[model samples]
Target: MSETRSDSTPESGRTVNRRQVLARSGAVGLGIAFSGALSELFAGTASALGRSGYGPLVPDPNGLLDLPAGFRYQVLSREGDRLRSGEGTVPSNHDGMSAFAGKGGSVHLVRNHENRVTARFAVPTVEGITYDPQGKGGCTALTLDHRGTVVSERVAIAGTAVNCAGGPTPWGTWLTCEETEDRAGTNGYTKDHGFIFEVDPVDPHRTGAVPLTAMGRFQHEAIAIDPQQGIVYETEDAFEKPFGLFYRFLPNRPRGGVGSLRAGGRLQAMRVPGVPDLSSVQETGASFDGIEWVDVPDPLATRTPVRLQDFGPRGITHAQKLEGCYWGGTCVYFVSSFAHSTEGSAADHFGQIWRYDPAAHRLTLVIVFGPDTEVQLPGESPDNICLAPGGGLMVCEDGNGAQHVFGVSRRGEVYAMARNRQNIGTPEAPEWGEFAGVTFAPDGRTMYVNCYTPGTTFAVTGPFHG
Candidate 1:
């Protein structure tokens, strides 16, 4: 079994320090006020921990979003809303996104639409702009003016499958991943699906609609690129028996030479010693030492499950539903959506957050969500995560009941930041949808998020430095 070092101490089967508690019983705000090292999460506020967030969320008069007292929001774009190009409407199911600085002091966003191959709302069909006409899943680029208003929105890339969550590259591009593993000629798709495509935030129209096949062909969820090492860390949202394995792509050139990732790279899976069956759901706050990566024989899973066949016997660790990831504070922080013990698992938890330190060669458990209930931990399923301009991480919930964008302090205290208030529910088709595409603008003055339902994108601003 591999060994792990905790706070410079050898992990010879010892308990974690009590002060190292990752999460409290209820909201993270309660824990932050008492946590000496993490009290800065709510620094300027009163010492008393009265409310859960910056303040009570003021109800939006338009009935779309509800944010804290001082925070304000405006709609940037919505599904079915006509684009500034007047060519097509904004696609539905806005899933993941990243923001970039534009020419005229504007912010450009390359947003994903999690629609399947057969969707009612299709991106605009243009010459030399789509990958597969049969597949309706793709990405859209929205240009926002200096005032945070939508300047022009158009189809950036088209003809993909289930363009879900992706990350921004230091070289100024968006790596959009197709969540589905459906292959060519299956399900009406002319070409094989499930690959990462690069979308140019500045001008995707000129960017080739090509998939970075070297990244691997699997059920992709999100990715975070280490700028210094030119390594791409990815997550898989698979829930099958074998589950998904966390991956890192080491490009042929350590610094991503002229060809970048398209130059072809080696795919490898992560391995942590001491975890049996390679699953981490059973362990909470479990530390590991001597992390290792094993090479993948095949990047594409043609005959068998790529995760199971390549890393299962090799002892590579597996996560139930690893979702979002972000590179911040010289480390990579990611989320394991959810897993349980009822299905013969090691442990059960609503959600989890992990931190991987490349320099130290360590993977640490940063946050763990407890069991779910009607009232406690209202935001359960953490889908996509992003780093805040100030400190801490913002998580978008994809779980049940009321969905919200949750904030986790550096000390691991979780609090509600925003909630969806759109009431478009019907008896047959529910209206509530999880929040996705949570990103901050270049200047850090504004934060943009999406409500997946009647799809609306919001630009939020407030005293976020709390």
Candidate 2:
């Protein structure tokens, strides 16, 4: 995956590539590694696709996975194929996605499968393995083109449960996130359990399951909506036993400026206000950084679920596996695939990129990955994040599957554009999985990545820097 080395910077040392032994280590934007075909010719001119930029990487383009030179990615759909809504395909793990842009230009993907009714999937018209033991996980609604193909598809939310990672709602639609309430023991979960549900990705109503329970339930992950600033960001895929919190919904219907938090919102959790609300949090290796902002007073419920530290502890640190969240520029970024230890108690190994400078309410960390030698990586975390309009930052790496969907460079340098590890090509030729929800196309120039274990969806366009 490493190639083209002109060397203007990035010599922290260590280099190997294909054999996998690279790591100049550093991350955030604009440098280059994994050989990146000579810095992908200075990272421009692949096409004007989605304009992008960012900086921080002294040189940490996380070595190997290729796709920096003149960027390009296509593959609009996959997962047993057969879309247009014949209602047969789609059924896998694929998590958190939300692309919107349909007036005619076409594109509305809401997708999120995370199926767990017993796995199986592959239902192209019910030939085999459509197995609906109870069906459970859901979310779907494609409508691609821009090269990612697939013209129509639906199913916005099925059996329900476990659906993981979601965000995108200023009134457009999409809030998926169902991460779980207690399904670990095997219980259907028809009661509010782990919530947040709203979809309309240009057509999705298979009975239209709507459960914004005011946006609260617990165990949910990924979801960040501000719609100009209406506020919604929530995340927490509880690894196990812990009240697990991180929320902020506040929309009781007030986009008077850019609102629409579902019209009836107010959900809130994660009480950094004096800290100490505990039940769980701090273990995935634990490390903890700094970023504090707490006030949900009780968006729906959670003045106490588990741990706010018993009810007295605030000063930052607490994101671990927080999974993706985005709002680039002014800042709102959020990711913690791992990190927690500041009395939170044990867990660490890398991943920590925080932000929330809501003008300067504070809360910052910016970049903080771990491996080093050039950027050496065995992989264990760093999930969902997006901001590549020409700004840098598109990581997915939920560890394993071969993991690949990194692009950190607001100066932290980390390449590996797309690599879902599938050595094949069908459904018209596609191969960009495991890259988890990374959108763009408001003008970002096409780029719709997905592939959460089986629910694939791609549509990347050249770097086209010019």
Candidate 3:
């Protein structure tokens, strides 16, 4: 069901191998070669002081997740485990997640389950929150103490499909996006999919099963809301011809609290004049000014996808595998998780990070992961990403070979913060799943991430430094 590849052989000692990779690439301790707005952006973050992340990863004896020496992870929930509410088992395909502060030193996490109709465990169909009884994907809410121990876990929303990566709102709610365009009766689905649903972290009852249809329905991957104007920037993960387009939803109520998005909004796709395909740009510092926004003729895609909608002569810009989005500093950062010529892309690359400056009306390439054969490094296709509390960025690998959660410093130094040693296959034919939902506690003391297969959630803590 989930994607996996076995290109590089599994190694025993990861520290030596990681160090050797960095040394050979001449990337250790060296400042990022390109200097401009990117340097200024990293400089604003506290962790961008050019310090390498918490050294090499130490292999776990349990053959699960490997982390840095001082750091350790606690299993919060597993796929087959019964939830604290005793309603149903934890669902499979843990994806996008967000952490919020709760009363009495508790923290609330609203996590997404990227499950479809055939998933083994579905988010229990709660009466009021069930959107479609036959649908088998949704979200769950987890409560943790200050010590990062799970206190309560329960279904927050149920009966959706393909609950993939989503973004947290400034008003303390999580916008879960469905990464599918399945209409009613497609694969037994009772309703249309590919819409964003808002979930409340503190109160599940407030988050009824409501789809913000104004956000445009076309294989939604992730969203980042500009805290200033409440403009929601979204990424599409379509892998077919014509690729996917970047979108921004201008909400009617702006930064209003949860459920405000349902009031209605105007959706628009981005256009960069001559740049029809984003992957064609290879240079790191390439800038596109005078950006334009084309109104999506049909946001609901009743007849056509938003990306495929005609926008006069100057068509909307599209990119391949657009995923992972976060709001930081004064811009909204989004990722393009690699492109391939064989996959019908204009150009090829491992991954790319782009920053859109709403104030300046400019879009700039921040970080570009060049073509590399080593899947063990950070240059692999980075899926879910977050601005690390200790500085820099935390990335989840969904690429090839081995899977890892990598730390990229402000100086462009890459370090392996954690590795996936969970072999879901035979010893002779090992299989590793991708990492998703990397976020931090409200106090920044603990980090929470999900291993997407066999569905495991972990809370990692230690001497974290920026």
Candidate 4:
């Protein structure tokens, strides 16, 4: 399930697991476009000692979320709550989510539920459109007013598998991705799973579930889109047996508007020359230039994994637990959740952030998470990241121990923003759930997030540092 990489370069022209090390081998030379741009953007550490945020969080007596002095949160939705039309109880294990504009000063929150066949709650069957009748995972839509009050709530799409983390398209649609490759007729699943489905945020019930099969079927974690070029960047959250690849899909017909993904697209995996099978857990601030994309032979790989598809002479690089990707400020910010010394050609680290500049064709290390034993709380496994309105990035943690919604500054400074204080369950057995679905409202006043365990969505408002 895991592989290690040596510091010394492999013999010239030698191939290992489709990775070929060439004669010219060294750290890619840094260029001004990438080096200077990042240096200027991240001039200094903004969150050193948690100074950029509202400050230390006060313990919540209600056993909910703990935030800073001026910050306050409102519980918008919770598990087992009544649905809009009484379809069923609200699903649990909420994951990634997005907030869109609604009529009459309201915001539509499109959220995902990461439940399985054994889940206590199941999204209602819609007959023909349901991917798997036995699958219990799906997404929900909640409408909240400007003050974070719920206006309406309903199940958007249902019967999918592991509706994990996904991104919102520029054209007003939520792309919910399935993180499992579980085949149909196996384990009670009646249909093939592991595909991205587009949900119309306006009216999910009427639009019907449309899975974008051309995007490739893999252990999809998250997706990011470049609005300018109409290209979609994807991350595969595969671990153990088969590794994941960083991919980009070029749509044959560019986005005319929402739901244009049905037209199909060509998939390609990324490869950085010289550093074949690049293990991204390298030295902090290291940069690799001129990264190339290799075409994937079969986009819909049922028997063989798309990442394992060989491209003859030039092979693609494999990354461990690739998750949480976003497109912002002309670059793609992605996360490698966790990795050990045994995987790829990098040192052991809990988490890492990579910045890919499409125009420059370069990938640079942005943040290097320290060991878990380290004292820094925010330096944990950062997942489900999004661009902050007030500069820098907002990261959700899924690491070991206490989970939190931390902030990563432009200069890679980490700081604690919010913590989970939900102590529900038996006295002997308690829950220490991780935070997910971190996003901001279109108006930029309210920040919405999800607690993955019992499924509680919160709308936090305060004097943000935008």
Say which candidate scores most in lDDT: 3
Per-candidate TM vs. native?
0.87, 0.31, 0.91, 0.86
Give stretches of model 4 more than 4 Å off. 1-51, 127-129, 276-280, 342-346, 371-378, 424-431
Tell me which residue pairs clash in candidate 1.
Answer: 2-273, 3-289, 4-288, 4-289, 28-413, 28-414, 282-347
User: lDDT tens digits, residues 176-241, model 3?
Assistant: 999999999999988999999999977778979999998988899999998889899999999697
Error of 4 at 54 (Å): 1.4
Candidate 2: tens digits of C-alpha lDDT, residues 1-466: 1121111122122112232223332333322322122122123423433334322212224422335445555666667766667776666767778787876576677777766556667222221212222545777677766545676776666766667778776667777777765433356543445666676776555225656666666677887766577777777766643435566666766562222444676554443322332213222221122223444333334334322323223322244467788765455666766554543534444666555544434443445454443233424367887766655556777653345666654333465566555633465754434567777766677767776655667676774232
Stretch of 10 with least lDDT, candidate 1: 28-37
Task: Give the TM-score ranking, best first.
Answer: 3, 1, 4, 2
Per-residue lDDT tens digits of candidate 1, residues 328-356?
Answer: 75778778877755553455567777777
Mind giving the per-residue lDDT tens digits that candidate 4 earns over 1-466?
Answer: 1121112122233122221111110112100011112332344424432234556677888889988789989998888888875777888898999999988888999999998887777766655446667889988889877666787888788889899998999888889999988888877988888899988877885557777999999989999999989899999988663478888988987763666888897788887666554454355456776677777777788667777766546566777778899887688878887776575535456677788888777777656554324533334577888866645567788865566787654433455678888865566765578899999998777889999987899999987775
Model 2's TM-score against the true structure: 0.31
| Candidate 2 regions with alpha-carbon error over 4 angstroms | 1-67, 72-107, 111-164, 167-175, 178-194, 198-202, 205-209, 212-216, 222-303, 306-319, 324-336, 352-381, 385-436, 439-446, 449-459, 462-466
List candidate 3 segments past 4 Å from native.
1-38, 47-49, 374-378
Q: Please report, as a residue range, the 10-residue window in candidate 3 with the lowest summed lDDT.
A: 12-21
lDDT of each: 0.74, 0.55, 0.81, 0.74
